[model samples]
Target: METIGLIAGNGRFPVLFARAARARGLRVVAVAHRGETEPDLEREADSVTWVRVGQVGRVIRALKAGGVSRAVMAGGVNKVRSMFSLRPDWRAMRLLGRAAGRGDDALLRAVSAELESEGIEIVPSTVFLQDIVVERGHLAGPPLSEREAADVRLGCRVLAALGPLDIGQCVVVERGVVLAIEAVEGTDRTIERGGSLGTGRAVVIKAAKTGQDMRFDVPAVGPRTIETMVRSGAGVLAVQAGATIMLEGERLIEMAARQGITVVGCDEHGNVGQS
Candidate 1:
């Protein structure tokens, strides 16, 4: 059987990826980060190896031992924890020391190169799960209103700028005014913060970073995203087409429709339409 290595991090994304890979007859071997990946993944994966947050050497060795020549990174690791709680092994420490400034792209690309040196190819996480990728079109309920559409357009521009800077993937806007930009606190918190700052009716846009390494940290959303929007009184969600991952697609759409929220996917060129 063919085996695919998974560097699993927090959230349901990693679990869902493992399930999808297994359904396609791929044996899933996961190197789950300590305190981040869900414990239930051990039951889902063919084999599970636990490693610290910054243990690059152990991750490589584990994949190599499993005879894995290709791997996908799924989900996100909270950077705050990495800064405050990391206990890197010697190899990881060396990589960190050599890093110029320890930015997300810098560190991940460096790790990818190290894995390549060990004959492991880092493949995009969307490889076998194209169905979950957001297509360019309207999703959920009705199309955005003129005002919401304008906000969507503005949100896209702001998010695009933030992407290249590795700032965050989400921005909330209303009537062409920027409400909040997601930072290390993440999407949900950003929504809540923006919602609190506004008088309701905000548009939230989530997109992948410019030149994002798809092997890791693909933008993801699901039912909870709608709940956040509802609580925050945000009326629209615009995600990047063919880039963002929508977990539990049917249910997510159902929930969004029930809440009367607009969900659209925008292309790389900022073309916003239904999925």
Candidate 2:
């Protein structure tokens, strides 16, 4: 079987990736972050090594020792918690010292470069699970109302403007008003904050960065996102089609339908695509 390395982080993405890889007859050797990665990952990947955030040296060694020549990064590391608990080894420190910026893309690209230098090629996270990458369409729930569509368009423009700066992938807009832009606090918190200030008509837009590196840091939404939206009073979700992952998509759509939340896939210009 072909062996692939998994650089696992928080959430269900890592486990889902591992499961997909193994199902395709690939051997998955995973390097999971302690406290960040889901415990369930251990049952999906063939083998797993736990490491702290910023332990690039350990990650390299683990993958190398496992005969991993190709790898993919899955899920995300909590930026806020990582700030307080980072344990950078020499390799990570070196990368950090030479980094031009502290943005997510810069840090992730540095890690990818380091791994590539060690002959471990980093592949796109979706290589094994392309089916869940949502295409442009009205995925679930009611069609977007005129006001909601306007909010989505506004959110998309705002997100595109912010993307080049390597900022967050999510923004919340309501009735043409920009409510919240995701920062280190992450998408769920951003949603909660924005939704709280809205009139139950918030539109959540998640998109990839301008010139986003597909090998890592792909935008994702899942069941938790829907649940959060339900609590936050966000009624619509517009994700960049062909550039986002929808984890447990069927379940997510079902939940959205039940909650009367609209889910649509769109382009950078917020033009909803045909299914």
Candidate 3:
């Protein structure tokens, strides 16, 4: 009965959100990026509007046309692409002027503020998928060794160190040796970069920023993540409990198990468990 706005980006996350939201009897009004979003989302969304990247005002206008006043940002845009490929409109240019310096979070916050100024509220993307959060504990495969755990702690510290800069949310490490820190290239590439440097035992840790704004850009991992980890020889995937999204929850964990990779959820304090 309610109408929700969805600002969709690339990959399966937006499609999943559309299906889940519609099932709850909410009208899904989606503004999707033309090249980044999956074309199949038209089947899942009640209404879909396509825009190129950086057309913030256009997105808001489309949502308003659909009678939506609340929205969620699902999936992701390639930040590198956004940096180099955007064609900002007048409003987006203004937004970029105000939000240009602080990295991803600042731009998202500015976008949210702009939407609010136009009477649209940005909701948490998990509004309909709360149960899929990576809970604290060992989710699949063997338990992590003390050495792996140390790497996890180190990863957490590194994320905390980097988060305030609005950098990426994941890192690949082994025995405290850092392999890759996720920048605009994204999580999978970061894992691949780190994994290739090691001898089949790198650990990938993904977490929220130290001062993360949960309304947008929550870290997510999916089947492709496991596939990448498998290819890169990363043996463990650790995510921050209750913050990271385990996309396609069961299948992702199952894939990790089949590949003999550990997928555990850890707390901010580094305690590990499954529940």
Candidate 4:
């Protein structure tokens, strides 16, 4: 079987990707983060090497030993925990030194470059499962109210404007007011905060940066997102169509329907089509 390398992080994404790769007859050799990656992944991946947060050298060594010339990064490492947990090797330190900025895109790009330099190409995270990606449409729940549609449009515009800063991919808006812009706290927390401040009709928008590197850090939403919105009283979830991935999409839509939360896939111009 053909072998592929997986740089696995936290959540189901890694396990899902590994399962998909294996279903296609690929041997998955995974480098899993010590605390961040789920232990269940060991059952999916053919082989797994556990490593510390910033152990780039070890990751490279493991992949090379597994004969992996191409790899995909799946899931996410908690940025806050990573600050304290990172144990950078010399290679990681060197890449950090050369990185232009501390933003997600900047740091990931630097890491991808380093991996490519070692003859290991970093492939797009969605390579194995393209169908999960959102397209421009009304995915679930009731058709958007005019007010909700306006909020979605406003949120998209705001996220696009903020993209260049590489601050975050998510924003919360209601009635033309911007409630929250995601920072280090991440999407769920951002939703919680924004939902708390809204009139129970907040719209959540998630999108890629203007020139985002799709090889990693792709924007994703799942069932947990709907659950978060339910708790926060947020009424709508709008993601950038063609740029966002929806994990467990069927379950996600079902959850949204049960909660009466509108889930939409929107374009840059704020156009959202019907299902």
Name the candidate that leads on TM-score. 2
Off by over 4 Å in 1: none
Q: Compose the digit string of candidate 3's lDDT tens values, residues 1-275.
A: 89999999999999999999999999999999988999989999999999999898899889999999899999889877777888988888898888866577788899999999999999999989999888888899888999999999998889888877888688999978999999888888899999999879899999988777778857888999999999998999999998989889899988988889999899865668433
Query: How high is each candidate's TM-score?
Result: 0.96, 0.98, 0.97, 0.97
On lDDT, who's better, 1 or 2?
2
Count of residue pairs whose backbone atoms collide, per candidate: 6, 0, 5, 0
- Sorted by lDDT (best first), the order is 2, 4, 3, 1
- Residue pairs with colliding backbones in model 4 are none
Candidate 4 weakest ten by summed lDDT:
266-275
- Model 1's alpha-carbon lDDT is 0.87
C-alpha lDDT score of every prediction, in listed order: 0.87, 0.92, 0.89, 0.91
For candidate 1, the 10 contiguous residues with the lowest summed lDDT are 266-275
Residue range 1-275, candidate 2, lDDT tens digits: 89999999899999999999999999999999998999999899999999999999999999999999999999899998998889799999999998889988889999999999999999999998889887998899999998888899999899889889988799999988999999889999999999888987689999998988988858999999999998988889999999999999989999999999999999988999562
lDDT accuracy of residue 228 in candidate 1: 92
Q: Which residue pairs come into collision in candidate 3?
A: 136-273, 137-273, 137-274, 138-273, 138-274
| Per-candidate alpha-carbon RMSD to the true structure | 1.6, 1.1, 1.4, 1.4
